[model samples]
Target: MTTATVPAPSTRADAPSASSAYRLSFGHLLRSEWIKLTTLRSTWWSIGLVALVSIGLSLLMATSLASFAGDVPPMPVVEANRQAVQVVVFSTVLTQLLAMILGTITVTGEYSTGMIRSTLTAAPGRVAALFAKAIVLAVTMFVSSVVVFTAAALVSGPILPTGPLDLGYPDSSVLPVLGAALYLALIAVMGVGVGFIIRNGPGALAAGIGLVFVAPILVMFFPRVESFQWIHDAAGYLPSNAGQSLFMGSPMTGITLEPAPALVTVLAWTAVVIAGGIAVLKTRDA
Candidate 1:
């Protein structure tokens, strides 16, 4: 059978193996998630709304508060800084809602459109994929929030009663503004976990809304009954309530934790929700 030997099919030394060629790295996964997040129309709309609402609220609050500048004595440096910081971040309430909806859609939209199957097939590691999506969402939300907060600060700076309301003089607003951005980022990440748990956009959104807004309001009334005072106290540990403590100048209607405790509480809630999501992802079909 030496008649015309095929020369062993001439494999090239540099040729990539099938596994290596198809392997998806974490960087690739991140890039893919970034693309998915940026290409969606809803993402743009949410971002636009964030900017619009933040700046609009900043103007409204600044002007309304400035009207009382003459009636009230000049605020102390610390108090004025706090008020300015509060005005700059006043829009966080609505922006957090937008962030939650956007984060939920980031995951649920994939499920609804049947893209998650393809994503899983490519990434293979379900947990890594979920984490990649969350990281991307968190980064996007943080950056967007920073920009919006900065814009709000600048827009409101001149309108605020200038004597004590200095955005840069005491540097008091910096940490709070940064904290607000971080808070929004964490909220978005929590929303990602909710998306994974619910896997339905509307349901996930409703759950997020309840957690962020309705739950706090409902819990506020619990203290009035005296027996449920513990519940009202416990409500301060809720994710949104705890997160708000990071930036808000004053406490909510219920018991409130200190800033450090609030940060820890928010982080704990996010970690628990994300762990639950990972557990569901591993045990369920894509």
Candidate 2:
């Protein structure tokens, strides 16, 4: 007896498990961005520059401070020490240039080379790809910053104690290192956001630097000018300057945001750029 054959369910050739496929897409996209970042020769230069800033510049400032100590007015040894050790923390600023460069290239390089089209093609969800780049850039910069900062602290900490300066090792060394790392990471990823939005490497780099360095300078620079002296009050609110207040502990000299408010300010700035970039990225062609 010929039983009527039940129609075999039609299997779509291209269909796969939706959830797993989606996860893999983002995972692959993230790894691709990471590999691209690391593969750049400039990335290594930037990393090396961080290490150099930590090692080279730390020694310079430490020695310079020591030289000035004899000429300066006397103070409590412990107070003097804490102040001396803090100078090493400022090395993080020199590294900010490299961080900005690395981050700018990560996004703008793709655009310059026309690889962004391929990136968009591979991941049709443009926002996912842009966000993935940001995530990778942030993690990379933060981890590297931590390693360099901690190593510099270790090398410089003992040297400080040798002089009249207190090392402030256990607490000061730890907090500043962690804080500096987070700041660098935020700066770098903020750069990525700027790059993705501007899409011009040099223009983005200048904008990022200006925001981190110039805007604050402008905000503060004109404070001496009579009509705009109020602008000085706004300087502490600039992203990098506000971010500096985040862990520098001792109140900064300027009219900067308080630490808690400064943290919020920096985060707000970063969120605005990154979120704005993501919105633009989604709406634009690759």
Candidate 3:
């Protein structure tokens, strides 16, 4: 009886296994984080607000300075260039708040929506996932900041007074603008760390605001009190103050740190915050 021969299933040696097919790489995690960041409606709104604030403020400052250019004596080339750069970056004080909020939401939103579990499950390595998120956030914020600053420079160029205010002079504008973008990127990274630690949208936002905004104001008072002189001295090392020095190319009033020290201060703050977040992420359940 020559019955029908049953054929056995073939397993090719080169075929991918289930585990190998599903394994996620660092690139995959970064791509996934970018996708998530871009897909959110809030991201667009925050970016739009940043642009509006930056450009609008720049125009206002340029117009005002131009009006007074006739009455004022000609300033030194270096001082005028510094002032011009400051005009473009003036809105950073407000725009940073938006950056902080956006950053906080980037991570906390995932937790709020219960998407974090799926993210962790897919990535498996929590630290890598956090790093991916931070990298994405930093890159996005930096690029957006640079674009906004460039647009502001272009829009304000015609309005600014001749000589130092001229955007045509690339000497002072380029590095300061780049530094401003870097500062915003670092601020966003700090927000991500805050979000990871807090894990609640509103809470994280408040924490970010307090750190970047309120804390500076609160510390400002300490310097005025004789007993709190030490705290006042420490205020120059604050992230916001240091960041100001970084973008401004000079220390703000009462801030002692120069550009180099300011950069170090900001980096230290970011590193400490991120390390704390990683510790929390490692110890706690998602």
Candidate 4:
């Protein structure tokens, strides 16, 4: 009896799976976004800048705390937590600068290099493509913010030679710490939305940075002007100001708002920007 030799198992090169040839699925989209994010040198640079500024400023604060010790009462552990939250969240300025670059890259870079056409073609639903990128960018920003803030707290702690900075206090810290991270991520998403609307790298960058820095300046400078008070109210609801409220544990010197309301305001801004971007994306050609 002659038995035919069993055929060799098909090699992947010989018979590729359907997955290798399929269009973008949710998972595939996520993976593609991840690739796009990590492949860019700008992303790494932005994240690194955030880490450096946060930790450096934290150490500076710790060093300066000694001067305040004389006139001010010894900071309570809760007060210390508040201070740390301020340092970490305010350092998100660096994160925002970098995130603006990232946002510019994420949307405008695609258009710059003519890759967005391919992206939309693969996904076939502009919203789906946008959603995938949004999910990836948001998660990445949140995680990085958490890591940088935690490191800042740790590094700053040891600078106070007398009393150790204790991050262990769960009561006043945990929520604020989390809020800081969420705020940064939300800012990043909002930046992405700005990019989608502007669709020009320089334009997006300027608009994003201006919305953060210039808008607040204009609002505060002209708050007394009747036409500008409305601008103040609108600017007050911006991501930077609203999100900064998460760190305003101490009594405000100039402006004040409750953290919960601030959070809601920031979320509303995020929603409006994102909706605007979606509308623009639907109408514009790549």
Cα RMSDs of all predictions? 2.8, 4.0, 3.9, 6.4
Q: What is the TM-score of each candidate against the true structure?
A: 0.91, 0.84, 0.89, 0.84
Which segments of model 4 are wrong by more than 4 Å?
A: 1-23, 161-171, 223-234, 250-255
State candidate 2's TM-score. 0.84
Q: Which number leads on TM-score?
A: 1
Model 4 residue 101 CA deviation (Å) reads 2.5
lDDT of 4 by residue, 1-286 (tens): 8978855567445665666667357988999999999998888988988888888877777778755666665677877766656655666655666766676668888888899999888876688788788889989988998888888877766665335435588646777778778877777787888888998889998988887666666655664666655665566566677767665452212244578888887788788888988998888877
Local distance difference test values of all predictions, in order: 0.86, 0.74, 0.85, 0.74
Q: Write the per-residue lDDT of candidate 1 for residues 1-286, one digit (tens) a residue.
A: 4687444433766566666846678988999999999999999999999999999999999999889878867667777788888899888877889988998999899999999999999977799999999999999999989999888888898888843355555456678788889999988999999999999999999998888877887876554676887787788888778877777844455677777888898889889989988999999998
Off by over 4 Å in 3: 1-22, 162-171, 223-227, 250-254
Model 4 clash pairs? none
Q: lDDT per residue, candidate 3, 164-245, as tens digits?
A: 3545556676778888899999999999999999999899989889888778788755546668777767777878888887
Candidate 2 local lDDT, residue 9: 46
Local lDDT at 126 for model 1:
97
- Is 3 or 4 the stronger prediction by lDDT? 3
What is the overall TM-score of model 4 with all chains considered together? 0.84
For all candidates, the clash counts are 0, 1, 0, 0
